[model samples]
Target: MCFVLYAGTSMPIPQKEWRNDVPGLSVEALTERESPIAVHFSKPEVRYIGSTSGCGCDFPHVMFQNGDWPWFDDGEHDPEQEASDRYNREALVNLLQATGEQTVELYGVWDGDFMTPPAVREEIALTVIVDPSFRFREQGLYVVRVA
Candidate 1:
């Protein structure tokens, strides 16, 4: 049950690192430069590559669309897209939960990131793809507390 976790709000700064107990999982602070483009040109086929050692954790390897692209836009998650979007999100969350990061927090997610990234809007959807029931409640979205 391999999956890619979309963490943080809006376009991630790309500098912020998401730390977790999962060993191989790569905590990337994504931004439009990497994600928006990935979705814009993602492939239609979705494949789960179980887990891998590359990231040091048992993170699932999702074969994103076209093999080269890392993300996909399954159309708008509106009324028409709700069922499928929920299915995808649930399946992804379920897999993450099963892997032990049950409390993985999906951050920076909103309704608009699904439609598209407007030049001025800039607010991208960041999802806490993991389920909330997991013990890792502390692992959800939040702004960094600065001193």
Candidate 2:
């Protein structure tokens, strides 16, 4: 999972030397440039990539469009979840890699958020695409954070 830039937010600045943990996952932040998804949606900050790396961590986050959320969740309990989450996340990313190189631009992402820790959650509106085999995949989006 990679993150692209957008205007008006306090997301972290990207640093070099970040490792890509997700396979075939490409996401980017658009700073000072127009986005391809702009015509369909409002000004978006992120873009899909054919083959490139973002300055953040790639963790598959199965978020909800149902408005459900993890109440009281944070990094305090992360050590317990890391191993299993990594395994599941890899599976999800692998599935999404089958789509277009630059699928859609996203709304509400801050400057890649590459330097932020995974504990904090940012609200993102993603392009909806349905893959019958994976109903949950209808929503495809990722947050770029520090490893």
lDDT, candidate 1, 1-147, per-residue tens: 212334332222223233445422233433444355234222221111121232212322223233232434566446533443444445444444443321222322222343333122122122443332121111122221111
Name the regions of candidate 1 deviating beyond 4 angstroms: 1-5, 8-79, 109-147
Q: How does model 1 score by TM-score?
A: 0.25
Q: Give each model a TM-score.
A: 0.25, 0.23
Give the 10-residue window scoring lowest on summed lDDT in candidate 2: 129-138
Candidate maximizing lDDT:
2
Model 2: per-residue Cα lDDT over 54-144, one tens digit each: 4222332233335453233453655544544444345334433333223322232223333332323343222221221122211223232
Give the per-residue Cα lDDT of candidate 1 at 112. 30
RMSD each, Å: 14.6, 14.2
Identify the candidate with maximal TM-score.
1
Off by over 4 Å in 2: 1-70, 74-80, 104-147
